[model samples]
Target: MARGTLFSSIAGGGLLIGIVSWLAGTAPAAGVQQQSPGSNPPPLDYSLTADSQPQPGVPTGSLTKHVLAPGKFFPGTPHNYQVYVPAGYDRNRAIPYMIFLDGSGYAGNNVRVPVVLDNLIAKRDVPPMIAIFVDPGVMPALSDEAQNRYERIFEYDSLTPRFANFLIDELVPEVGKSYNLSKDANDHAVAGISTGGVGAFVAAWNRPDQFRRVITWVGSFGNFRGADRLPGLIRRTEPRPIRVFMQTGRQDLVNYAGSWYLENPRMAAALEFAGNDVRIELGEDGHSNRHGASMLPETLRWLWRDYPQPIAVREPQAGAGRGIFAELVPHRELLPPPSNPAREGGAGRGGQPATPPPAAGRGGGPRGAVYALIYRDKPWEQIGGVYKSVASPAVDKDGNVFFADLAENTIYKSDAARSVAVFRENTRGA
Candidate 1:
């Protein structure tokens, strides 16, 4: 049985995972990359301020706050949650979102989240998405003079799926009361730092249907009371609908708990091998929010790169090694054939065949769908099947094309026409 806090509601339930599987990797022992002196620099103490800009078209409204009590097996504890209303968010127009763990971290120390969000919305660097900042619960002491008790790790570090249930079932529905949150999974994101980072991955890993985009800093994916077995579990399970951006420092925790440096890279490699959508940046610093904070603007941009796009999990071809490690994605649609032969071009949900349309001139149109891959630099050039889903296409000065594979967790170049070829996998270490 799993022991952890759970948030449940009528519509759907999510779990806060606690136990982890510690399976190993396939990389050669000799080529493992270690954190370098420059990369593993020290962490920053204070929060860094962000450069703010105008935010037009964002839904503008006062945030509605809430304090709910845990019940049943949960002990009825109280937790705080906040909603961010963009400049022009409308009930009619559904908006995507980015969720935050530990509201105080971003709302206080790293005020840059909202600031960067405002700037990004204005500059069109990314689409406008709502922000949900939540705090872990703390039970009140019996005596008046008793100190307020904290339960950060005990609640966040576990691998059970209860916490995710709380957000989707309890937190999200409550947010829906004030504004319209897109029910579509493609519009959602989740993020955190430290143990919160591990919790973030656990949430998405358990409920990728609700959270397709994830950002974590210094995740604790080690064997601490059974939470360190994620790398192996990832290799064993079929890929889920997720896009993960992981960041960690060399100087992060490396005590009896586990090494953040070693764990982050190992997890990244496993995600790649299991055919997941993942990105990682290894820095030299301790286990703090400084680096996670500094990269907030860029991270948000990457997390929401493929906005309003659904993330699909590609199964490996038969007879492949381990079978589970092979995955693929076609995130973008190629330029339509001058005339679509299949009519609609894209497949139906669940990769099922689409309904047949009327005759060509009467109502039937082009049904053919080409998985056209395009380059950011050369929009005219047609690249096919480079990445499953991409925030933006990668293009070079000479019309070269490249894209990241979430499953292999690698970046590859298509043979001039975006044909698939191996580029680099971050297995050895960072």
Candidate 2:
């Protein structure tokens, strides 16, 4: 079979989609279709032709390459990145900035990001900004036979806060040492394709204080280690000062991991549901750089539109209602009293004064009443039976204790009645 056909058969025509469709009672149809809020329109051809190249009167920018040594976040790995400084850049002033992942693939003539930036900046379509294109890291092999460790999946696909920390704490600061990059989050943006697209979203989502604009193309928001939960998170968390633009194709990857085509629409809907500034563009293309590169110029324009006008966080819409946020936001009725009335010399049941409880840490008390001394050579009574190993203990409002056992990979709960039971099992090898 042909390579493309083989991949499609393995990914789209496999048991993964079949099982999902069976469970949902509907099968996903083939072909690309726009799934936006309003009337869906055909995607425009943003592909660069002869007319799209460098034009007269447009000042060209400088492209420089640099290497970043692995830092505390991803030790022993190194990365290569490039920077595009727009023409007429002044070192004295802070310039708007953007970071793109999968750097090498985007810096070529086909993408022509630098050229597009020059034209856009000259036309006043986008603010003159510095673009940092960073490639994924790689760990060197110890021997000839051993394969080099690819850091792409771990750095991009895994939804860990460490990647964001690496970008904010390491990469940005390293870049800022030479160039006067804007410190304002609203002046910063992140973009990437495929898995890198998800990484861009993760960076902005985790630290909206550092990045307010995000552009993702064919983001891998599938079962790649909890990324599928992003839509739910967007609905539940307080809306941030973020402007997002997502582009995906109908024939994008559809495998056990997830369907890129469907995930982006879900993300856009969730963003809109949370009252965020979001846009989703669908196309008839597949998982490739052609569509994304073609749309890069327009994407930047939309991202930096109304430049210097700080992106604002919107109030949660009442009509949109709340997801987990409703339970999280503090309310007066939900708060417990500062002090327990019954414990503070107030009447107990039947309007009678409650008995004064023994004072803790006091010198003298009734022999058996001084239970605080239980640790002093006394036979300690176990409220609940012992477990192999206990960790991450927590209690609820009703005095029910919850904990996890790492050895057994089980979560257990002990109620106020001292009864214990397994709360959960097989917690993803936790």
Candidate 3:
């Protein structure tokens, strides 16, 4: 039941380009960080000049509309998408390409991505690239008065590989049928705003072999169904060959999901800890496209700055801490054996089983008993059992002990009287 403009394709020559410019002299917003020198050049004025716009003699590209059938990825859901081929596109050459989510909004005049692409492609600031703007799917309502079931939240916010699979398996193949898209991951990029922004990152994260560059603006990296765990995943997983650009605003949404303002920085820190190539830009604006649209031209340039340069993976620094590296890495040290064998349950100097020393204030307790007294003031006793590889032991207030035998995937318990019994059955190899 979702309604919008119908599908249509327009040749580059038929699409009119007009000159529009925004002054870049305005001071940086309150929370905006100034770019460092030699870094991405300051955001240039995206206003189209006569040369930047399509002139009488200037070569222009084409915009084509496409519809993806329902049930192709999401059952009973359909989506509309647009593709923009730059002015210099050559059918024979394998060119760089990018996929943008929230297609209708971005493809419109508000974002004017095609116009930005046109200007940048003309100025040689960015390599000639194809842009695919894809809208999220919608499930139609059965009645006219009923509302349609929008799938944007489910499609964009879920932390699954299905969306990525849809792109890599269905959409990319569909696009490839019409154009010579590059097979090299270096030439592929994915981008989106807000929920779509998170989707963009997820797609590349799940399928780095298909896409290697990511741009996320005001991304919903908060707890929108497990997305907040991405930072931890990034830190724990081995580094992948992907470059990332992230942007967020101080005034972004802070609701039941979580604060976008905080999550973006956390993600950046995790990416940095993992030694991935990542750049983040922050501003005072809210969770809107004002900042993202204004900076899109520069973002595209930075994303593809060194064309064909293979994105490099860095070795995670030692002691990065709080990741798989920290948990699994071994720190070796040399130490002499215990000076007294008796303390380690070994034979004493006289070649007899050594009796452990008693507590300072307690007497008449069993030797080597971990506890000196039971709750009833009875002597502490050891359970009558010989166990193999006992692990993760716990004791109850009633003087009962519970432990697991990981090798057998079984749990055992001991009563106060030193009797042992199986507490549980197979534990699925845990």
Candidate 4:
């Protein structure tokens, strides 16, 4: 089989869309539960696409399962993980690989990762690679009176380098013991959904040197365990060589923390503001993985659209993003001088005229509204002395303007009197 066209890579060759016939109609799956959905969303009768199903002509891969005893990372806990080696994979040559959190979650049911990999590899749509399906660790109960300890939240929800150390220091090296794994960070990817979805980002966020690509489906980047602070973190930190593809539904989780629906978009905006390559898809379904699973085949295509070439951090463009991005606008003329080399031939042989920065108030929209507000009437004035990172300034009905110091996850309010004060602290990226 030959590789697909460039468009096919981005569009997944239109590989999705045949996953179901709606077996249950408007009724939801039995015992389905969520905080936002009063009645569980409808259950889906999914039929696999040719790519997601076993094909008579496609080459199949082998999946081997192993038990992992908890090590220094999380002592006394143990779990299981699986490894996949595509048919005809060479023992001497190293190959790319991916990490899938909530391992068994994606391996079967609607995803059927083994089958999907077989088809994608056979068609040469994605590079031949290995996949690690990782199940969360749990502390076994010692007696009938003792309750078992679940580590999923502490492992996946906390936004720290601990989980990253677990993967990069312990789990990955253990997997490498038996197989020839690629050492290039660009060749590695991490993925997860819901709580595990944020886990995937945390892996790469803390260690861009080990993984450069991130895939999340309805990622729970909310206040569950300080994950909502991710967007602000991205806005202030230097950009990492990472590419991200996230899927969020209109009807996602919402609780005492905040709305995942709002957080995901805000997260995307943060990545954009930080000059990172990011893509997002918004659907109409609930928080369930129905939509994310249906688009799995296509999501992979977009994640690795251009192969071999490394994913790199992009330079922030003036007026290109929301929140802190407005600070990048230029105060001088938008066009280069007529005698400048850029205007002559250095920029291009055709000498195309440079596009001016987005119009001040009209161009940046809400992003620049704060900039306009700051420089309006006269010149920009320093309101406060200390601010690590500022993002999302909005005016209330009473003419009170509020903005966030993303690094601290604190929101500040500037009242009509022009005095700025702390409105809320520990917003968790709200």
Top model number, TM-score: 4
**What is the lDDT for 381 in model 4?**
68
TM-scores, all candidates, are 0.61, 0.65, 0.63, 0.69
TM-score for candidate 2, please give it: 0.65
Whole-model lDDT values for every prediction: 0.59, 0.69, 0.66, 0.70
Please tell me which model should have the higher lDDT, number 3 or number 4.
4
RMSD of each: 19.0, 17.8, 18.6, 14.5
Off by over 4 Å in 1: 1-65, 71-73, 145-148, 314-430
1-430 in candidate 4: lDDT tens per residue? 0011112332643212211111111213211113253635444443346677788978889988898878998999997899999999998999999999878667755467778888888888889999999878889998999998978878998888898899888888999998899999999999987788899998999999999989887788877788888888887787889888887655566666666666776777678766677766655455556667766777787777788899987655544433222222344222212333232221102333343334443324424334334322476567765899999988754557889998998999987567999999999988
lDDT of 3 by residue, 267-381 (tens): 7667766667777665655555667777777777778887778898765443333221111112311121222433221110122223222222211121112233323346565
Clashing pairs in 4: 19-47
User: Whole-model lDDT for model 4 versus the true structure?
Assistant: 0.70
lDDT of 1 by residue, 327-353 (tens): 111121111112222321111111212
